[model samples]
Target: MLLSGQSHAATESRLFLDGKELSLPEKVEIENLDGNVMIPIRVVVENLGFKVTWNQKSQSVKIEQRDKVVQLVVNDLMATVDGKQESLNAAPLLRKGSVVVPIRFVSEQMGMEVDWNNVDKVVSLITPVIEPTIKEPVKVPPTTGSGTSSPTTAPVVEPSVMLSQVNTIQFSENQLKISLSASVQPKISRLTGPDRIVLDLPNTMFSDSFRASQGLDNKLNGRLEVSGYPDVSGVRYSLFSSSPSTVRVVIDLNSAKKYTLLTETTDSTLITVQLREEDSVNIDPIVPNVPAVNDGRKKVVIDAGHGGSDPGATSISKKMEKDFTLAVALKVEQLLLQEPAIELIMTRNSDVYPTLQDRVDLANNMNADVFVSIHADSFSPTANGSQTFYYQRTNSKAFANVIHKYLIKATGFKDRGVTENGFFVIKKTKMPAVLLEVGFLSNSDNEALLFTEELQNKVAQGIVNGIKEYLGIK
Candidate 1:
């Protein structure tokens, strides 16, 4: 009677209570099985002012709220509501060590309204308001009817501020703008690990149009993907809490950079976040091969294409191109480090992505003698070979020819030869640069060979030899 197999592949459903999103316990999830939205019993009932208890002996659960009581047995279609037997579309069950029950049955039986948004996979439960019943005045109130009673006024409650738009704009600088229907004091803080900037707006909710535009119905959370901007990865927003009606907005950052929050004096509904480039002094410590005073050693910058969030290509076996590129680039660095006559610089030593402009700037600012970028290509499965590319400028073609010769020999694939291409990194760099596509990741045979450590070492050695031969080093 337990759910198994492909039923677990169903998308996890989001739970909301009276329009506020409820954070589920870790490892406990809301699931849709056979079209029935199953929600964790304890999470939903407790939020609705109900007490829940488990009976291990009978494998049953009891939920109580005021004078009402509901009991459900595991894998049983029959449930008891106030001692009355009722049928269920889907029986209560255990998922990820938590008891989950059918949202509609449990919610409706407890005098709560239940709504499901199938498109967005959201389950909304609304608790009905209970108004106090008025009793007829007694005969004693007639004695005081001669004196008029003064009516007391109720306190006014302000409506929640609406978050109308969250968008990015490019003007003099890249700015993230948040539009609101009213003014709000936002709590701002910075987080690390994967760097992010978080802003919390009090008493705010997403406007109807904004929510619908995000494809969210009754769901209080969504994400916006920012394209063409190098500093930012994406933006995420959610109704963080319901008690105070707080909205949380998180900005995912690519790297550590200075940002300014612009507050409008006359218009308080608009919030602007401006991104600024990191200071040179703050940047030098993290960047490799930035010389305070050069001693005339030849500088070479090694770039490993695509990393972190950007996986360049997927191999036939599903290996990432970023991993292969970094592996070979590191091996080449190790081989080149032993030479006293050559100075080595790496675009990235770890699995992190630097923007293409960042890579070009690093080489140009360091005044590197040569620049080389490593990448794995993806095309038809039948395509297998090694190729190198260079922009049509200076001695770039000659630089590519020297590297391609060694690279083709090490890879032992069909030689694709050197070609001219206007790749961003190679074209922007001031000195001679070449982008090497070592092997076709889509080809099974080449993918298998490229992943081997022995082949990576050979490829690394070939690249070092090519750089040395090009520079007339022994």
Candidate 2:
């Protein structure tokens, strides 16, 4: 056998920075910090409730939160928290005339761990390390042949590749499943070690070409590593099959190495890894170790802002912002039902008040993809229109902007655009978070329009469109 050669390339993955999500194709590179790891004095301090200011003439970075001022010299590599010298990862690098400090150290100082995984390459700042199970195994099928090799197969027959006998491959909807059959059946066994469990298919000298790829759909983290299996191409996926157990590792090929990633399904959903080459695998699927979000469902967290007698802002006719948020949210529930890909959730579906912290807690528990808080803005009686707000710390500004732009256009309301606000729900949700000030209840024009079913449909349609765009839907 001259070995008919072909290979599958993995898709791309990404992370976020400065409200901008960076798409890293193959590897996530974390540069070693040369400076002392003082809090960035920018990202960390400001995120931790400190006020921030930029001095152009002095080239200084200043922060004030809770009656304390933090000052830092841009090039001097020095700063003071309440007037004290502190270390820095990089001297405040000047960029666009503002002091820019390294992201890792700064986020770390804010009591968070700045992590950049090299395999999938996503920069995540978490309060603690979530040790998601990593599956790494080696399986061997019962082999009795001329002591040579044979071909592999897929459960669904692929007409493109012509091989003698390709073993059947199936995924277990219940427990992990595996099987093997060949003229020369190879030994299939389970292997386990610290933090990994995988199937080892023996006598398979895998031949492959490692090709670098980028994030496929902002969900998958593809990495290529050469393990013994020909099915594994590019960065190998270390799947977690619960330490050591009997699992199937079938090598079916014409010329492709790939891994299938299955996420919870819904309407308006995108299955990115399917039909793509196996060279890419979801190396670091955010395995929810937290029981709160580990139910394995594509979760959503909806927030209704300014509640609990807080009533937020009010209008002359006495249409409370809280009441309207609840009403529209209930309407949104009806609209979202049209698409099964999404699950509808709300901080307050009823008139009951939910604290900002409670909203954040609910969202975190849900492991939300998009955290949306509905509210009515009250700036001035004349200020009428719809707007959206997001936290500058939790990077999702692009997504926020997308929704905000279309919402204003679709609603024909005043355009307040997208903004970064320190609302509690936006500040703490663990996923792509945004808060929509759907309209100005204080504005007589909008307050009257808010109750109309036509306006509700427009807002729902706009929100649905925004979600489709983010998911790269046509």
- Which prediction has the highest TM-score against the true structure? 1
User: TM-score of the candidate numbered 1?
Assistant: 0.41
Q: What residue runs in model 1 are displaced by over 4 Å at the alpha carbon?
A: 1-293
Instruction: Return the TM-score for each candidate structure.
Output: 0.41, 0.38
Each candidate's number of clashing pairs is 0, 51
Give the RMSD in angstroms, all C-alphas superposed, for model 1.
Answer: 21.6
Q: Candidate 2 has what TM-score?
A: 0.38
Candidate 2 regions with alpha-carbon error over 4 angstroms = 1-297, 472-474
Candidate achieving the largest lDDT: 1
Tens digit of per-residue lDDT, candidate 1, span 119-238: 667776655322111134222211100111111111222344233343221111134557677655555555443556666665666766666656443546677777535667888777
Tell me the whole-model lDDT of each prediction, alpha carbons only. 0.72, 0.48
lDDT of 2 at 412: 89
